[model samples]
Target chain A: MTPERGATAVAPVPSETVTRRESTSRRVTGPRPGTGWRQRLEIVVFVTPALALMATFVLWPVISAARMSFYSWRGFGPMDKFVGWRNYELVLGDDVFTGAVMHNFIIVFASLAVQLPLGLGIALLLNRKIRFRGLLRTIVFVPYVVAEVIAGVVWFQLLQPEYGVIDGLIKAVGLTPPEQGFLGTPDLTLATLFVVLTWKYLGMAVLLFMAGLQSVPDDLYEAAQIDGASWWQVQRRIAIPMLGPTIRTWMFLSMIGSLQLFDMVWVLTHGGPANATTTMATYLINQGTGRGNYGIAGAASVILFVIAFVMALVYQVFVLRRDTKEAR
Target chain B: MSRQKMRTFGGGGPLVYALAAVVVALTLGPVLYGALGGFRSNEQLARDPAGLPDPWVTSNYTNVLSNEAFWRYALNSSVIAVVTTVIAVLAGVMAAYPLARYQFKLREPLFMVFVLGLLFPAAVAIIPLFILVTRNLELGNSWWGVALPQAAFALPITVVILRPFLMALPKELEEAAMIDGASRVGVFWRIALPLSTPGLITVGVLAFVGSWNAYLLPLLLLREDMRTLPLGVADYSTEHSADTAGVLAFTSLAMIPALILFLALQKRIVNGLQGAVKG
Candidate 1:
């Protein structure tokens, strides 16, 4: 309901509020007059369970992580060793964590750089009246629906140095496979990871873009056609421009997802060979769970939280504001 | 318009079909390879790395299907997913109902709390969550440890989607129910719940799929025999590294439940995502 409705529902006659309150308080020893108590009970009953769960699992952990960041605890007993900002200093100084941050930024930019054009191109093609459109859409989107770990495991098997299908195909094409394989080679690991990431995520981009395309009114296309514009011209001059909000929104999602990339990397390389593919997530996991460096992990997590928060705030303020304002 | 213009604007031609075919092939190639690779023996794979099974063998699939461990993982995954979905949908519906229909002072701010939750990724809070679940709550190695947290994480999207659905319902029905002496709770149960089945189903399916495929939470909370399908798939691959065909069989089977769910309710899933993004 709207604010005005809520306001009136709470106090029907504002001028009588004091008298009503006095009368209700005076009659508290007897029966209540109206549905106010019943409504409040209903609201409390309905809202408390979710709020409890959220506070326990979601809100509490975030606060705990922030608190844990300043302590040198091994994730057990008492977290009494208050090391101040030493953990943050160590995490920032560690080359692995710094590299992880760089890798995260690389994926964030690479996803937008690569997926944008590729996804848009595919979306445009699929947007046309084509045969097997539903089937094609389903096929493209299957990878996105599949579990990331499973996809990583499948690709890991398929990327196994000599025995992997990809390597075998490369060999069959009269090209030499990498000596240590795509993922095994440190220099190629991040790039190779990006390829798999693209394969796994492009479906989502295309699906979202196609959904956005549906919102572009057909009248514009018809008008363009009436003006004797070519198909490419109509798309460039009309469809793409109309997709600005969708594109910006998708980019925002992509950036957030890329920053937190972990599942696939964890499965495929474990940020492997030479720590080439460590994401902010994998870095924290490695430090805390893998190495018992809970303090460092806590610091890294906070840094990640800040980075994601800042980037999201900046994007919303700069880019997404237009879309929301337009929606309003 | 000429035939060329019609071809350009109306139906995509042979070239478009060809491009679509290539895209489809690229998209499904790895998935098919993994699924079909299970039909070949390790020796057969060694002989022809990319070849189809000349004589399709059923042992790999049969072996994985018959394995007790595989079924154990599947059962664990199903139980966790069901628990997560039930909790998430129930809590989401309960919370969304008041936010959507009731007039309250804290409604907007409370809704914004859930909205803020959207930007809070699970990874950021995961380490502390693991500590909280294992040490503090002592829910380690238990289904609720994972299910409860998964459901908690699923709440934001669930509420975001379901709130709109509830809001769009005709307010007159609620008013009529109230006039007929039905309590708000009664109207919610009798009218709102039944009418919002589509939204409920959408959020339910999302929560289930999400819990089923979840890795980090289960990976941290569960161990050994308690592992879910994704973890099972990863561990099975590593343990059976020499058995390529068997590993493929295991991995392929691991994905089937989610794939079937997606294929069956694809339109709903797509629409749910669209609604979430639009909202």
Candidate 2:
């Protein structure tokens, strides 16, 4: 799916001539007068299965979640009790839900704050002709490819209070380790989760930045060099500016991924250490599945959806419009 | 772009290498430690938490490999991933074909529906999806219970990636086939499907990897023997909380399939991401 180079080059031909030729061919092959009906049938046959699956699985659940938020249901039985907006009120007023919302926003901002510069720095360094570039890139991306649960499990072991490798290393250097371990300490849990997230996702940013760099024509760099510009100046003025669209796109994705953060946090701490790392997703799961508070979970899910949808919409309008508009 | 020219134009120096080395070490350190820690006995780990195994015991690996539960998880994961991939690719390609090639008025709106699906995370729908699957569909504890939704989620990315590929196929080929009396279906089956193999492979690999690594859906849907590897790993880690080495072994073994698949198709996966981003 690399960008198609010349696909649009065929669009400028006169449309009337093309339609006339196609019509003449169709008239010549006049035996098949049922072609229109046949084509419509083909469209139906080809598209129906997917449309059905999506409607049933994706669209239905979304609508159901909205419907579910209005009623008080444990998980089973009939939907008799209509609680109206009580669930939303409860979810919003609850300190834990508010805390989860805070954590989600923290991750969303923290990811962009930490990963953007680090990934860009690495991508810049690696874009140079370097030995073992391919191998280095692969190693960086391996964690991303690994299952989130597995990564969480590995980190969970590494952060064990006394016996974990991290504490052991700290002690080896003559510094005292945390009594409750990094992940165990309520104050440190969110920070530790952020660190793990950076480890897992920075590679993607670097990869994307590198791809964006590849698309910046070599001549720009050459021209900058001819003008006696410094390396940093070239990157700042030419390379990075050219990467605007890529950076915005990456940030949008990162924000969405962060808001939905669940897998790693669930496996590692279960949003534990006194729920310090509870995201919207974890809070919903903790309510819906863990305690059978399906109504609260539904409300939380709807809130999460709305937050993500608004952010995506705003980003598309305010931030991403330029990139997409340029493409069009 | 040539290496020699790059060097002449001031390529990366020792400082760059040093920084890159540090980043790589930090990235791979925990993963390597986990894999190697499995070879150490509990006592050895207790004694030297960061040290290598004194005598690389094989029992941890052997025990996990021998355990019937581990294999069951693997089998369940394989089946679910395969089913999810097949359905997602087949349905995704079929839908993407007409959306890409046809001039129907509803095509744009339909494609937009899938595009909007991109922003809809499974977490948002997990609650009602649970109710729908278990209570309404009665697919609880079955492979389809998880695979169906997973495929549904997979559809957006699949269509997004595959549509451009279908659209990029030279129009003359289809026109030629039509002139030769081949029906639209004949043209699609004979021409469109064959030429879009790369796109198919890209989407297929992505779907399979996604299904294999999926956790939340399988966690809720599947119970007992139906649990996939991620759930199994969580359960085993909890059950064997004291057996750190065994947990490590199980975790490492669980990751191998995904890692191996990734290594094999590393290029396509990277390209696919680029494609998605660009699109």
Candidate 3:
């Protein structure tokens, strides 16, 4: 048994222990009992459910879908002869796919512009002591925890042109309400979804930022305060720079989440109003499941994986290492 | 100038209070509207859309309770959620504690695989997941179709989290138990498990929230007969689109269980999310 290496080692500390263990697993310590042949097999028993599910549902499906790129199967039927890269060609050939990718860029932009800033800003504000701090923090987080179906219900209520409580409230204070719900229009739909998503995810973001924030010591804040640094100045100079690692993490997560956008959009818009808000996820699902063009859907899935994998690689390779150096 | 600045200050007093009031109002406004929306009659919904009920009808609740489909969906969701949480927590805790305690081979790769599971949005994996459930596994159109996949997906992160909490376990306590001739199982079951109940509860509650409000997985894997609360509500709302009031009522019904879960899990889940972020 490896003696307990302490709790912090179990954390994501980039430990050598992790590497050493993985390297040794493939090599043999000779088949024996408890910690040997029997143990390894039992470990597989412990791991099999998760492994099988991950493989069957996650890995196997992905591999099958990747192969579908060679066929022109419309999802419901037999693969009508391999077209060999034709699906990739078709996807590349199509303007809709290009637009979808471009729109995904919009989602990235929206996250950077709205959710990141808003979440960080709120987190910074709430991190300080003030009366009712608990209440305020909880209120902000409510959006994230609220069910998407309920958020869909709330947004539907708020945006209803005639009966929309929001519209009525706006008119009560006097502004010409739009003819329809913002989601009912094409130009506004994606932006509107962006806002709702930001709202829903802001709580999660703030929670993360708070975690990063707590690690920055009170002594630093006190010293800065004594030096006559304004609140904003301290925040910019101390907090932001101190939070570099966390910001990267939050941004990385937001990107992954943005790419994976589904449930709420599916509930609220169903990628409608002429597909103005079409995300890669929505488009993939639409083709694969909705239209039953399984091959194309499979292709979309592979592309999604490539995109997420590439981003995670960059984060793991460059940014995470730099953050480590900064801390050291 | 000093006097003017002072008026705006007091660690952000009245002004901050005013702003917070706006924040609270904006946050609560829609929920207030939806809750009240279901109360008003259809004519009241259309004519005096923002007004309170004339008869102050509680019949929406009664209507919701009387519907067999509604009760069935609610029951299905609760049963699935409770079962999935218990199983996931037990399995996740066992798996995580060993990984945290052991210096076994392939540990990092296994850990990475679990983290990879977290980072992969189920949407991408969902397509192949559907085919596997329907044809390969032949488990389609059942609660197991949804519950099992949810437990699997949730396990990776949930386990990673509990590992940290378990590693935080005091070595002396376990050593003492071992000195008493306690087997590994005895130590874990009696000591470590009891100590980490907080972590277990956090993971369990989160799993509950995720499964209870789940839509897409159930929608894909299950047929009409197997609809859960979320799927049922979404479908019912769509079918009764012409009945906007009815749609709101249905949405309200769907929202209750989630609302209750959130209220219950808010403190633990928030703290857990913080703990798990770095991991």
- Model 2, B8-38: lDDT tens digits are 4647689989998998999999899889999
- The runs of at least 3 residues in candidate 2 whose Cα sits more than 4 Å from the true structure, single-residue gaps closed, are A1-34, B1-10
**Reference-based lDDT, residue B178, model 3:** 64
Docking class of 2: medium
Candidate 2 lDDT tens digits, A1-328: 1111221222223234444554554444333555677778988999888889888888899888888899999988887799999999999999999999999999999998899999999999888778888788888888887889988899999999998999988988999987889988999999999999999889889988887776666655676677687778777777787677789989998999999999999988889889899999999999999999888899999999999999999999999987665543
lDDT of 3 at A61: 66
- Clash pairs for candidate 3: A75-A294
* Highest-DockQ candidate: 2
> Going through the candidates in order, what is chain B's TM-score?
0.94, 0.95, 0.90
The local distance difference test score of model 1 is: 0.86
Identify the runs in model 3 with alpha carbons over 4 angstroms from their true place. Answer: A1-42, A76-80, A322-328, B1-12, B52-55
Looking at candidate 3, what is the lDDT of residue A75?
A: 59
Give the best candidate by TM-score. 2
When 1 and 2 are scored with DockQ, the better candidate is 2
Q: What is the lDDT of residue B201 in candidate 1?
A: 85
Summarize candidate 1's per-residue lDDT along B1-279 as a digit string, tens digits.
242234347468899999999999889999999999999999998888789997999999999999999999999999999999999999999999988777668887999788778788899899999999998899999889999999999998899889867866666686678678887789999999999988888899889989999999999899988989999999998988999999999999999999898899988777766655555
